[model samples]
Target: MKKEILKIALLFLSITSSSTFAQETLDAFLKDQPIIDMHFHITKGYGDNEIYRHLNVDIDSAKLYWAIEDYKKNNVVLALGGGPLKYAKMYAGAERLFWSGLIFPCTKTVEQDKPCEKEFYSESELREIYQRGNFKSLGESMFNYYGIPPADKRLEPYWKIAMEYDIPIGIHADSGPPVERVNKEERPNYNPTYANPELLKPILKKYPKLKLYLMHYGGEYSDQSLNLMKEYPQIYCEISAVSMFLPKEVWEPNVKKLFSEGLGDRLMFASDYFGTVRKNIEIIYNLDWLSEEQKRDVFYNNAARFLELSDSEIREHRKKLN
Candidate 1:
């Protein structure tokens, strides 16, 4: 929890330098409403206080226990904790709080160990595993990092499984994180083309019922993101790491463009980084252009619809509206 305390201290320091986040009324507003953070991670390894370290930017880092506390503190009803199977133990008993994802066609496969292989699952076999494990979604998948687009022939059964059992999916559509100034591993295989938002067109064509979302809004491809949503009603995009890296002046306008184009309803709010949830929340909650209702849509309603939160879950979470 030291990381979280340090982050709050840093953010308190940050608000002094920049006028980019929560006012007193905004804090009250956020506390009163429930949120569904569509792109949170259970991991706490953002390795920050860099690049913008002079300004004390702590947007990308937090502690694991601290993040859970933050989620409940912020009234985040259902977080799509977008990490792989290895991270599932983090939420062992807190199943109702977040839905963890399995990284499909897993990245970082060490060829010798074959650590990322998936065995065939018969219907009954898969059902038993699903009951035992909490992989509610197949996602934060590394198509961009490994340069495998959603339409690759290998993903045929993956899509079929999602359609068959109604598992929601989230994928890495961003061009991956910018290389760090130090200790950064160069992404030799990273391909920007795989991150393009338009690439999902064919995948959706085959399975229009698929519950999928572009996790990072396609890195710098926000325009294509806008068009994809315009063309296909099935597409939803969340702005996370990309926004945290940008100055609010440059970042907020991209958001305004979606609102201006009538696509704001499908844009979900996500703080992919940890401890920066309030920063990300305030980015949407205090938007001057959006009505109170519209801001709620970005914060909660849109993701709720996209993820198909059950009526009982909705009713339970809606209690925070009071």
Candidate 2:
């Protein structure tokens, strides 16, 4: 398949604009480009705050006073952020970010029950937020870390709301942090099988129209993610940290495998970056295997199509960029 899309250089935006605060200069090809990041996080507590020690920008904690501006610098027209409603409202009041529901349920375990756990919206609470038009999607759900599956009965209410409102659900169906690197005190339960994409089969059958975005490209179990997508048209995957964290040799093959399966259009881009948004975007933008157009879809079109962004909304995003 000869790759068909925009020219490489044409896809960049060479900018010295004030929007970027004079620190990051975007390539000209990406000038005023539109990208929809399907995975991002905002938490009341520290979450993957130190995943990439190589990057100069360590969030230190969940301090996000710099997050909104970071999004603007990298041309993230829209982002599906996973976190509590309280923080979502604070950040998204004027930004294009949308809350994708809670990342984890209130803790049944002692550690999670403290100052932050209760902040996760309950079913009734999410419904109220939805009613007020504050919430949009659901999950980025880290069920695996909790040793639970997507089909667990405890998650029924979330599925119900997703069906009722037609919002997409994002699941962390990827492997957890490397064993040696797993936080010392917070060694998560970290069940690999719990991240299995097949667990979503029941959910699909129950809510046929519901959209599911599997974050991390299924991590080590990408084959499972690929299989599920084959079986269920509504299933999509986000190539988040896979490109950023894995050895390119390790992760690139998986990406090639996806295109080989003809799942390119269903594939979406995500940084899940709490900082240095351009570092995340640029990696995908520069994929050796991707043509300009395929990169375009991953960055913007696929997500826009998946989210069903209205024409007006899409136009407005580009309007701001130019």
Candidate 3:
């Protein structure tokens, strides 16, 4: 009878130990998970201060470098957009960063006096830029900032180029931070009217092959964004600034709905601001409603499928940490 009791105790201890070992903190899970950030921007010096100031946060070089180091330590790779590409070039050869060709419109204000022309790259200029083989994606394009609709005539050739190269395009669409948050003097051209997700429908119909993800998951347009994802197999959305900046009550439900509707595989994780990356990861990780598989899909699997990383490539990436 003592031997029987001893055996039962041993079995109970073993099960308890196994259960303890299996349960992990969100941070621990993220440490082991590979993350691909599809909507990252590299800001230089105080260039981003004005925007972040609205959030009452201060940024400096040291903080920025720390964020980059955190990404490297966490096995997070970035699909980098916005530039002065020199900032991204700083981390070149590390293979941690992929560059996106940026396109900005010349129109400086909401007024009609300014003609809409390509500011950063003309069509021909962008072709040369892509020919250099440095850019893996095209944009973080601010179609709303320039007041150009996605189906506008000016952007047709650019879309064709994206199709030709099979390059993914990231666009800044829908309302971002509240307009009152930004200092009007600093961002005089800020226009929320043009930032609607509905604007992209015609463009999606026109370029079915265009690999694109709407940045911010079409802010405040959860229903429309999900419909687009369902209608177009190619459309994907990243939870970036919208996830971090919006009130939790507002953002959490939208994300939950996406998951409940079976859009887990189509969602990607991102922190548009470097400082918020850790917090953003924690936010998603702490959600009790998401299963381990759903978390894995959001953290890495979705991005792997989106970027078309082969099995060997994913294995190699995982092998690096081990």
Best by the lDDT measure: 2
CA lDDT, candidate 3, residue 107: 37
For residues 284-319, could you state the per-residue lDDT of candidate 1 as single tens digits?
766787899998888889999988788998998877
Specify the highest-TM-score model's number: 2
By lDDT, the better pick of 2 and 3 is 2
The stretch of ten residues in a row with the least summed lDDT in candidate 3 is 107-116
> Model 2 misses residue 159 by how many Å?
1.0
Global lDDT for candidate 2?
Answer: 0.71
**Residue-level error in angstroms, candidate 2, position 44:** 3.8
Ordered list by TM-score, greatest first: 2, 3, 1
lDDT per model vs. reference: 0.68, 0.71, 0.67
Q: Candidate 1 — what's its lDDT? A: 0.68
Instruction: For candidate 3, report its TM-score.
Output: 0.77
TM-score of each model, paired residue for residue: 0.76, 0.80, 0.77
lDDT of 3: 0.67
Clashes of each: 0, 13, 1
lDDT of 2 at 262: 93
Q: What is the lDDT ranking, best to worst?
A: 2, 1, 3
